[model samples]
Target: MENEIAIHNEIDLQSKIYTIRGMKVMLDFDLAEIYGYSVKAFNQQVKNNIEKFDEDFRFQLSSYEVLELSRSKILTSIQVKGVKGGRAYLPYAFTEQGIYMLMTVLKGDLATRQSKILIRLFKGMKDFIIEREHLISYDEVAKLAIQTSQNTKDIAVIDQKVSALATIIEDFTSPEMKKDFLFLNGRSVEADIAYQEIYSQAKETIFVIDNYIGLKTLVLLKSVPENVKITIFSDNLKKGLHQKEFDDFLKEYPNVTVSLKRTNGIFHDRYIQLFGISEQFTALIVSNSVQLEILLNL
Candidate 1:
């Protein structure tokens, strides 16, 4: 029976786990399978009791994460629902604690038996990591990522190969973006990814020019590394971003220093500049006149 349980752990349990947002998690589809429910039904149940799941317990993957996970066989499987013909919503992922909360909400003999097995498995995994914590450090993980992907483009492969530790490094740190040119039109998510990736590279300061800047702009700037000074010039703060909204954002992300100023009709365009180490710089031109025809010039 011990041998049988070990086999079950390796196949039914560990194989379903994936590293996401610095935590090991199971996708909604996989959890639905184990709990004997349709993906739609399972998600609906969780939504009904959403108060039980916090950001750490459950969270939706970002658009870029969806793109990255699509490379995985489990995600690419045709059986996965809510991901076809321009997906209505991204899938939700559940952490170990989330699974614990979920078992309380779900009923049935299968759920009861499976929850016991899962708790045992979760305990084992936690104990193993605790015992080996001294063997792992943030610096060591960073060095591993640097060594494995000297060519940063292969960084996605790290997500596939060394998912657990790779996810920790990727989450705590940003990846190198090698795009020399990115054109954006009718693509909100891709544009957001580009904005975040470029901003994450800034070591000291950022310059921005957008006539219609708003709270959403600050949301994008949330990706800028801590302590990076940001200066923005906008023609329509009254109509777009208000002082209150700006203050709230600053309070929430106190580490991100930002200043907003009016363009005063000096410029009629949108662009961004990133200043990094040794005074190196990069530029992005996003035209509001064309409804965001963006160009990031590296």
Candidate 2:
């Protein structure tokens, strides 16, 4: 009977875990209940030990995210703690590391038991994934080649599904030149496309920090979302970019707004900061500056 009860608890815990920002996480409400505390009191304990929970560990949900999660049935519709009419403060989501950190602050039998179960659950998942990745290899590639030669009916759909699954596995395990994009000589067009793709991910703002900027940078800014604001910081060395260039850029892409500010020799290297609606990503700079053909895959 104890074993059956344990199985039921595991199922219940599994339902509370959800994937957000490509990481498995649990919402504050669910975690609070698991740890035997009210959501209000739970958050208070976190606040008391706020230093432990960094951005990777825990992050608050944006209003848009709340609606999105609710629509997908990942989260239930709920109002802010004290607000009456509209949603004010969205709940915080804790990553695996953050959930582990919560136990240190929350005491008692419930916290201890839940922490042990969570450790076991995460360990099992890691082992399962690590073991399965070995299977998406020689057999799958041979099958793909065979299917292509035979002119299969669902070739397009099948290929897409296979590629998507491979990409997910690669994102976690393979160091396919991880996080570093090495552009070669005569690949200016490809470099520009890569930069545009990274810029397009920003929902709110994109801050480009380069000590030596030029007219060429304005061309890259054109791909950013019309609603997102852009700020470029460059030193005096950026004399290559004339006021006329920016004027021409704005005239052509009036919807894309970009602001330029001089750093006056403060920054040493180039960096791109992509700020999402609810989260902020910082310091994604190619090593040894950008003109040297180094950029982020992120």
Candidate 3:
């Protein structure tokens, strides 16, 4: 039974290797967590060093791709916020070589330790693969038995494989950890969701901006508590651009201050930053001419 258990464990691990289809992928944010860098900073590094990473090792997520991920229910706690426009480049997924390159680039005490541990773990997996291949001939009889018996032994073997696969997955991916960061994608809607999260945590200091504001946005902005200090800066536009009713609603919130900076170029990119108790959360929104294109595209 002990030897059977050991062989089952090895088989389960091997099955996953095949199941993965030889494509090693790690989310950019997850890799960032390992390297002790914020996801934003980590992505910036990748953007800066595009030559080091090929399409096989790294690729940005498209808006549609991100939307697909949102449907998976994996993003329960974190909302995917958009960049300046409604579209967002998805988080890059890295291959094995990319992970190795990342460790080299992000070298430090913690990174060194994580790299060493990961390398050793991968080595162990490789060894397990080699050992399993050598034992393939011995398993032929067991395999034949499994095929011949549609009985209890076969069911037990199947169950063992399934459970072992589960264990290997748990070990390999390092699940069951708290998520440190999340992403939000879309236009101003993304900003609204991300800030609401900060508000849920009872944040006080918040900064917001939107060159094109309307009744819907004004309603969203009104949700902020009066005690909270909010400074909103936006591009100066012709009076009555949004509508008289929308502008009139602004008078109701004295604590929430809005400033319009005059600029010929039109302050198009919208962003909101919230300095909570300890951490900072920002959501980028696109307004002005870009917003028109987004609506047209939609």
Each candidate's TM vs. the true structure?
A: 0.42, 0.42, 0.33
Candidate 3 wrongly placed segments (more than 4 Å):
1-22, 62-87, 133-298
Cα lDDT tens digits for candidate 3, 1-298: 0011121232322222211224645567666655667677878777777788888767665556556655656433223547443324466667667777776666566666666755665578667778888565646988878877867777899999999777644433444311211233322223355446544443676665665555555556666765666665655344423547645776776555444344455557766666654656565644332221121110
* Cand. 2 Cα-lDDT: 0.74
lDDT by residue for model 1 over 181-277, one digit each (tens)? Answer: 2444323334577677668878988988888888988998987888799999888745888879989998998878899887789886567777766
Better of 1 and 2 by lDDT: 2
Model 3 residue 5 lDDT score: 17
Q: Is candidate 1 or candidate 3 better by lDDT?
A: 1
> Per-residue alpha-carbon lDDT of model 2 for 1-298, expressed as tens digits?
0011232266678888888888998898788777777677889899999999999999998777666777775556445444476434688999999988987988876677888888888788889889988777776899989888777757877998999867644543445444344343323224566777667878988899986677778888888887999999887383788788888888999989899898877888678888764555554444542232443433
Which of candidates 2 and 3 is the stronger one according to TM-score?
Answer: 2
| Candidate 3 structure, TM-score to reference | 0.33
For candidate 2, list the clashing residue pairs, or say none.
none
